[model samples]
Target: MNNKQQIEKMTDMMSKFIALVSYKLPDDVENKLKELSDEETNPLAKTIYNTMEENQNLAQELKRPSCQDTGVLQFFIKCGQNFPLIGQLEKILRDSVYQSTLDTPLRHNSVETFDEYNTGKNIGKGTPSIFWEIEEESDKVEIYTYMAGGGCSLPGAATVLMPGEGYETVVKFVLDRMTSYGINACPPLLVGVGVGTSVETAALNSKLALMRSVESKSENENAAKMEKLLEDGINAIGLGPQGLKGAKSVMGVNVVNTARHPSTIGVAVNTGCWSHRRGKITFDSDLNYEINTHKGVKL
Candidate 1:
């Protein structure tokens, strides 16, 4: 496709894809919820899981968002340097969010930081936040679309610790936060932990961690071990489904880490409630596309 045609196709495709994300949980998430519900022994938690299933059914049937918040849009893009629309990708995504907001009828959750006013179209400053990665040798682009609801990603916390405080402190910090606020995030949660050199790096890492599949494990053996330990620790809290109590408190815990300054250790936590509205899609130079997170989706 030519440059102009590529841009228009991309914008239209993404608007529909993101709108689909509002109502549908990705395949991995849906499967994880089913697994947790099936294994859950608590009657109340089981019932809550059933209700969540019913809610998904109704959302699909009615063609509306499953959760009321719908969340502010966030896009993580990995684009080829040679992609025809690379320069225009940002505008295309911004326009996509605007179009999706109208077509999906998303809730107006964006407010200016200091001005403190809702942007009715979900198009306020920095709304539909985009983070980019450029590939040098190809012409394909991959995008991950996420909805950060107030109860989930918005209220998350982060901190930096002294080197003397140790990695153990990171464990303690995450556990303490989950114990104190995880329930409020509307469990069972997809917990994302970021460990890096500073609070900002850690914070962004935590978000990128959430973009991975619940079943994924870190390639770093130590990090993978930490993921298991954290997962077990969080689940042992018994916050369960909707925090009503059950066998599992989270779908899974994902840890994304980076080299840190010797004197400092940074950690941040972000959560995705059971109805995590995240989706992944890829497009080739020709604008032919595929949805990676949701199976058999035409868009």
Candidate 2:
């Protein structure tokens, strides 16, 4: 196919994929929520879980988005240096998002900074934010599309602690943030924590951590253990579905850590609500594609 054809094809695929992701939670996430609901002992929590399940079912059956806030589109791209469509990638993605907004009936979430006017097309200066990571060894491009809604974004917090504070402070910081703000984030959330040398790095890492599978664990032994500990502690708080007081506060807590400066330990926390609207797709140099997050996904 020619460059124009490639752009059109990719744009079509992305628009369809965005619509699919808006309405469906991945199979693993769905299963996790089911397990949590079955294991929960609180009546109120159980009712909330049922409501969430119903919401998903209705969204799928009616071919509608699961939530009203479709969220600003964000793409995390890992593009191979030699990919055929490399030159046209960014423009194609921008066009895809803009087209998808109208084609999928996506909510108009992008607004101009000072004018404060809705673009209505979901495309504007720095909108449909794209983060690029170039790789040398592969011939395929992989992309992660995430929808961070208002509720989930509300509880995001970050801080730079004195190095003297140590890892214990990291743990405390996450817990404190969850306790103070997580309730507003629409519970049964996936908590992402980033620990690094500065606030910006920490914030970026925290967002990246959310892209990891809900069932996955950190590679570092210490981090893995801390993940489990936080998971248990948070669940014990009984935040239950939508924070109505239940047996589980989170789907998981993923901590991504890196070496930090001796003087400062920065931490950032972000959450994905039960809807957790995100999807992953990989495309070969030939434009053949795979959608891994949803089962029997045709697009």
For lDDT, the strongest prediction is: 1
Residue-level lDDT of model 2, residues 1-299, one tens digit each, is 88888889988998888888888888778988999999988888888899999999999988788999999888999999998888888888888887878877789998899999998988889978888999997889999999988889988889999988888888899889889989888899999999999998899889998888888899999999989999998888888899888878999889898888889999999999998988999999988999988878786
For model 1, what is the C-alpha lDDT against the true structure? 0.92
lDDT of 1 by residue, 1-299 (tens): 67777788889999999878998899999999999999998999999999999999999888899999988899999999988888998899988888888998888888999999888878888778999999999899999999999889644789999999988999999998999899888899999999999999999999999999999999999999999999999999999898999999999999999999999999999999999999999998888899999999886
| Candidate 2 local Cα displacement, residue 291, angstroms | 0.8
The clash numbers for all candidates, in the given order, read: 0, 0
Clashing pairs in 1: none
**TM-score, model 2 to reference:** 0.97
The whole-model lDDT of each prediction reads 0.92, 0.89
Give candidate 2's whole-model lDDT.
0.89
